[model samples]
Structure formats: C-alpha cells, structure tokens
Target chain A: LAKTTQPISMDSYEGQEVNITCSHNNIATNDYITWYQQFPSQGPRFIIQGYKTKVTNEVASLFIPADRKSSTLSLPRVSLSDTAVYYCLVGNSMDTGRRALTFGSGTRLQVQP
Target chain B: EAGVAQSPRYKIIEKRQSVAFWCNPISGHATLYWYQQILGQGPKLLIQFQNNGVVDDSQLPKDRFSAERLKGVDSTLKIQPAKLEDSAVYLCASSPRTSGGTYEQYFGPGTRLTVT
Candidate 1:
C-alpha cells in the first residue's frame, strides 16, 4: 500500500478556490490517485481521478506532476455544499484485483458563509 | 439507474451479540466492496468481490467477520460475538470496472452499528 499524507483541515469561503494537496512519496509506478468527498452522515462520493498530468471535470480538477509523488484536488468557486471531508486514495486501478483502494487520513474542508 | 442500497440504516447491539448488514449493488456492476469507517477516520476496506468471487479480504478479521455475495448481485456482511470496537459505519460500494478499470465507485448510505 502506498502511504499518503494530507492536511487535516482547511478553511475557505464561498466562491473561493480550495486546493488540497496529498503526498505519496512511495507511490508505485502503476498507482493512480483518486479523490472522494464525504459529508456528515453520508457515504463518500467520487470527486476526481488522475494518473499523470491534469484531469478536469465539472466538479473538480486533479493535477498530478511528472514525478507523481504528490497530487492536488482543486475545487473551483466552492459553495457551502462543498464543505466535506476530502479523502485521497492511491492504488493500482489497472491491477484491479491485485491491490485494494486505500484512503489517507483525509482533509476536512470547512466552507464558511 | 439506482445506486447501491444498504439496509436497516442503523443498528445497536451489545458485546457478544450478532448482527448482519445487507447490500444490493447497481445492476450490471461487477465489482462490490465493503468498508468500515470509524469515527473521525477514513473508510477501511474489509472485502472486495468481483461478481460472485472474492478478490481481496486480507483486512477482514475472520474470527468474527464474514461477508458473501450471492449471484453476483447482492452482498451480506455479518459479525458474530461483536466487539465494542466494531461500532462503526459499514459502507457498501460498487463499480462497473470496465475492461480497463473505470475506477468509478458508487457508495450506499451505509449501516451504522453501535456495539455497546
């Protein structure tokens, strides 16, 4: 399992861009980085995923550098509803059955009104 | 287009008692997973099933925990003689896992177990 580290908490206001970074210095060559968001009393939801470079979607953007040692999840113009615990996962998606999807401690994003 | 479904929403049991949780994955989804989320922590994978076959269950404590998927559609996780530490939210998720691995997982509402 590739160990990952992220901030324990972050704070932002509505309309602000929130960027949470995760570090996985020992990430394997086949490992891909994925992010999930969880609200209180609710299960997590997929946010974004990327192997290398940048991948953007309507909700968030994932930026992975060439070294692949770290990645960032960027939420654009966030709203109060975006306040949740954002978890970072590093695993081998291609080798689906070989390894399990492991999650980091996660970053708690608090969006103020 | 229904997502994964979990039942009983919440359960409370005493130590040494037994409890079971059920999950129904989305139609056509081939990969199902069970996870335990402790308070203030990330979800930990307990088991993963590819259709009706078990793929990974290294984290599961076989002494008290067991899970199974029937007909590659629905799954059940049970704990015998539950322990206090077993109090956590049990989550069920599923994904299509297309040829190359879409890696998109849909999660259910989860069953919160309170073991006293």
Candidate 2:
C-alpha cells in the first residue's frame, strides 16, 4: 500500500473547474490510483481510476504524471451537489484474494454558490 | 441493478453491550468487505471475504469483533462488549469477480452505531 497526501480542504464556486492533487512518493509499479467521493451520511462512491497518463469518464478525469509519483482529479463545471470528501487510494489492484484498501483522511471539497 | 443492502440503518448500545449489523451484497458478487469509518476520518478495512472464506482480517480486533459471510451472500458483523470507541459507521461493499482483480466496489448505505 502506498501512502497518499492531499490537501485537507478546498473551496470552490459553482460552475468552476476544481482539481485535487494527491502525492504518493513511494508508489509501486503495480499500484493504481483510485478516487472516491462521499457525501455527509452516505458511503463513498467510486469516481475515477488510472494507472498512468490520463483517464476520463462521464464524471471526472484522472491525470497521472509520467513519474507516477502524483495524480490529480479534475472536476469540470462543479455544482453545489459535488461538495463532498474525496479520497485518493493507491494499491495493487491485481491482488484479488485480498484487496482491502487503506484510506486516509480525505480532502473535503466545499462547493459554494 | 439493486445495490448492496444493509439493515438497521442505526444502532445505539451501551459500552458493555453486544450489537450486530447485517449486510446483503449485490447478487453474484463474489467479494464482500466490512469497513469502519470514524467521524471525520476515512474508512478502514476490517475484514474481507472471498465467497464464504475469510481472506484478510488483520485489522479486526479479534477479541471483540467478529464477522461471517454465510452462503457467500449475506454477512453479519458482531461486537461483544462494545467499547465507546466503537462508535462509527459500518460499511459493507461488494465487487464482482473480474480479470486482473480490478473491479469497482459497490457500497451500501452504512449502519451507524453509537456506543454510549
């Protein structure tokens, strides 16, 4: 498991693009970066995942630098409902037998109108 | 498709009492997971089950916490003589079996426990 560091909190206005960065200095070759979002009383929902380069989906985009030491999650045209806690996790997804994820204190994004 | 289902959305118990939480994973999912999320913190994996067999439970406090996934579908997590620090949300998530073991997890609305 690779430890990740992210900003504790971030504030943004509605309709603006928001980006959150996570640093995993000791990331391993087999590890993949995954992001999840959680609202006040609900469970975390999967947002995006990537091994390297950039991966985009209907919801968000994940950008992994060439070094793989860090990744950023970019949200476009953010709305007030997008406010939530975002978690960045790095782990070996190939470990099917035991894929217990380790989560840290996530970055809390506050989308204000 | 129906997502993971959990029972007794909330529970309240005394410090020395026993409590249990139930979870029904999505149909056909071969993997089930139990996680504990304290306030203002991220979720911590407590146990993982691969079709009725325990795969990992290193973080679970064996003396008090125990879990089982019978029939490889529904599961139960129990705490005997719970402690105050046990107050947190118990989350149940399941993933479909896929190649490379990289399937996205589907989570249920967790059960919130309050130990007084």
Provide chain B TM-scores across all predictions: 0.97, 0.98
Clashing pairs in 1: none
The TM-score each candidate achieves on chain A is 0.94, 0.94
Candidate 1 has an fnat equal to: 0.52
Pick the lDDT winner. 2
Give lDDT per model, in order.
Answer: 0.91, 0.91
C-alpha TM-scores of all predictions: 0.96, 0.97
Docking tier of model 1: it is medium
Off by over 4 Å in 2: A96-100
> Lowest lDDT 10-mer window, candidate 1 chain B?
B96-105
Candidates' DockQ values? Answer: 0.59, 0.61
Give me the runs in candidate 1 sitting further than 4 Å from their true place: A96-98
Task: List native contact recovery per candidate, as a fraction of 1.
Answer: 0.52, 0.57
Q: Which prediction has the highest TM-score against the true structure?
A: 2
Which window of 10 residues has the lowest lDDT sum in candidate 2 chain B? B96-105
Model 2 over residues A65-105: C-alpha lDDT tens digits? 99999999999999999999999988864663334388889
Which pairs clash in the backbone of model 2?
A: none
TM-score of chain A of 1: 0.94
